[model samples]
Target: MPGRLLWTLAAVMLAAGLVAVGLGLRGPAGPPQPPAWAATARPVAHHAPVMARSVPVRVDVPSLGVRAPLVRLGLEPDGSVQVPAADRPGEAGWYDGGPTPGERGPAVLLGHVDSAKGAAVFYELGRLRPGHRIEVGRADGRVAVFTVESVERVPKDRFPTRRMYGPIGHAGLRLVTCGGSFDKDRRSYQDNIIVYASQTAVR
Candidate 1:
């Protein structure tokens, strides 16, 4: 791809959706980062429904002091995920294509590491440590509580699409944002920071 087109797509990916932000491209950098599954050996639990279906209204990461409203996001025409506008960079968005929080599958959420203004939502996402609690408020008057499992930084070229999007027979949540050093030349980050969490309780 041409440099200009690559730059444009990077902008759209990072500024427009979580797919690109979670999946980083491998450039002249070294070997590709290992997949999240390979990075951890703990088995994901398979459980029956713990809560009813409902749209996520807010995400609260008390450890990061983050409390933001969630906007519903869908895929773009090209089949890529859509992200919130730059103007609303402080807000996070839930991918409508996947399972809703507290549901049976992975619920994906995307947010900008920062906007032109300053720090945006998920700026501290990478700081979230294992065992930290993540609470997602649902429209059905329930809150989906998840416990951080693992955090992985992977290159986009090796994005684990099938694994991240695959059905697991249980409730899961994936929080994604751009990571790695920003390449001024490429106008994008070289890696994606992914926070993996599994539903523990809902009320």
Candidate 2:
């Protein structure tokens, strides 16, 4: 969202260069850009798991007075969501392949801790502690509640990708957002804070 234009340009440049090369042409053109999604040697599918089309009716965190709508989004080639810009900033979205909230697996929700401008919806997510409650209401009229178990901040360079996105032994929930100090050069947060929770109650 913050650098949408930059990403668009990179994608376009990469696509163009690939097309030219495949046509066996010589290019005295500008530097080639990285592909939008890298062209892997093996086939990879970006398709998300099909789930019942149920709207996120509500999200409630009494400690934060955070009761808001939830949206679903697919991951980018960078493995992160294209966070909504200013108008609908702070909104959270689900990673489709990850588990659903009330089901038996890890459900992931991602939000922007802050945008290029300022604090975003999940700016205070790091403050939550074990035992704090998170409730999600579904369009099907089902409400699921999860209890926080831990909160951790890890550097982006060493982000625990597998632990955060890997298979889980039980029905779990994770809330992720940018944290730690901001990086001026990178124009992004230096760390990512995650909140781990598990299914406690459902209605």
Candidate 3:
């Protein structure tokens, strides 16, 4: 699909807000513009050498002590990307429609921050800062190593779809989960936490 349309769909998904994590809480927050890495990040037009496509089977963040098997996720009836099954809140899901790990595009993953039971896969996502490492183990017996560049916590309404999903020449990964304040009445988070990283190696 054309990058433009693909990102538009992703934007729509973000706009709709992730399918609400856990249940019951109250508050609101959002990330600022011009991510910290903006000065160093290459512009979208400069094509980098991206790796061949491969199915990502696992994800790990050593610094945060996060590791999980990846399940494929597709769009919902309303066009929003589906979240992992609520019962399996500890799992993280990859957006099957976008680029695979190591491929030259944004590889999206979504996980719950917390479930009714307790902390979920990406509960510590907000604590991540630039320079952290994220690894994606692919089906072909290779792992794509990515270096964290920024972590953004933004309101659901101000979702930065362009920066998160827009055209890019190098392989990228986005870790997303509900964040900020929770609305007890709405039973949802008022914001989202997005971790941005770029593929730096294949092992």
Candidate 4:
């Protein structure tokens, strides 16, 4: 219910052009700072290394019951990350400017918490727990299996740019959606829910 309450209001603003697409990807000024917990958070740990050069086709999070097709998203004219079409809020968008899932960096997957009508793809994203598995199917026929490390609820104004979109020593994943409470006057969610995960397996 909290997710829905925050998601719908943000969705309404996103539909109305009040909220920027992939608002958390880029800050108005500079690069993002890695979250405080980054040092303790282990990268996706596994045996041999695999090069992730393929594009993502879909993302499946069994714990949250999420399986959504992926769309390639680029930056806007002002250099902000682009999001899926507002009309199609259920879709998830992969940031093409960054490494693909299973790659040696933080691959971004963004979705609307809710749509204009109701709950969207990532409505229950905040419910995911550490160690949850997130499977991302790639265009190259491999599934990048990631293990969740942590989840944080941060204010939109203080989104960690470096910790989130920054380069990592190993394959990583970031699942982002609007969270916190909705501000009626602002017509948007005041916080963001970010899931931090690491690539642990490939198949």
Per-residue lDDT over 1-203 for candidate 1, one digit per residue giving the tens place of the 0 to 100 score: 35675455454444343343422232345222334453453444534256667999999999989999999988688757787777787789998977899988788898877666666787767777667789999998889888887878867665655456666667889988877666665666676777888888867
TM-score of each: 0.79, 0.68, 0.84, 0.79
Consecutive 10-residue window with the lowest summed lDDT within model 1: 22-31
C-alpha RMSD in Å of predicted model 3 compared with the true structure: 4.3
Residues 20-57, model 2: lDDT tens digits: 11111112331122232221112112122223435555
Candidate 2's displacement at residue 155, Å, is: 0.4
Candidate maximizing TM-score: 3
lDDT of 1 at 134: 94
Instruction: List the pairs of residues colliding in candidate 3.
Output: 25-182, 25-184, 26-182, 30-154, 30-155, 31-154
RMSD of each: 7.8, 14.9, 4.3, 10.5
* Cα lDDT listed for each candidate: 0.72, 0.57, 0.75, 0.71
lDDT-better candidate, 3 vs 4: 3
Runs in model 1 with CA error above 4 Å?
A: 1-49
**Candidate 3 lDDT over residue span 29-68, tens digit each:** 3212234443243322223357788888999999889889
Worst 10 residues of 3 by lDDT: 24-33
Q: Which stretches of candidate 3 lie over 4 Å from their true place?
A: 1-11, 15-18, 21-49
lDDT of 4 by residue, 1-203 (tens): 24564344334323323343333322232122224453245544555265649999999999778889999987665545677776786699898877899888888888876656566777777777677899999998989888988877777776676677655688889988776656655656677778898888878
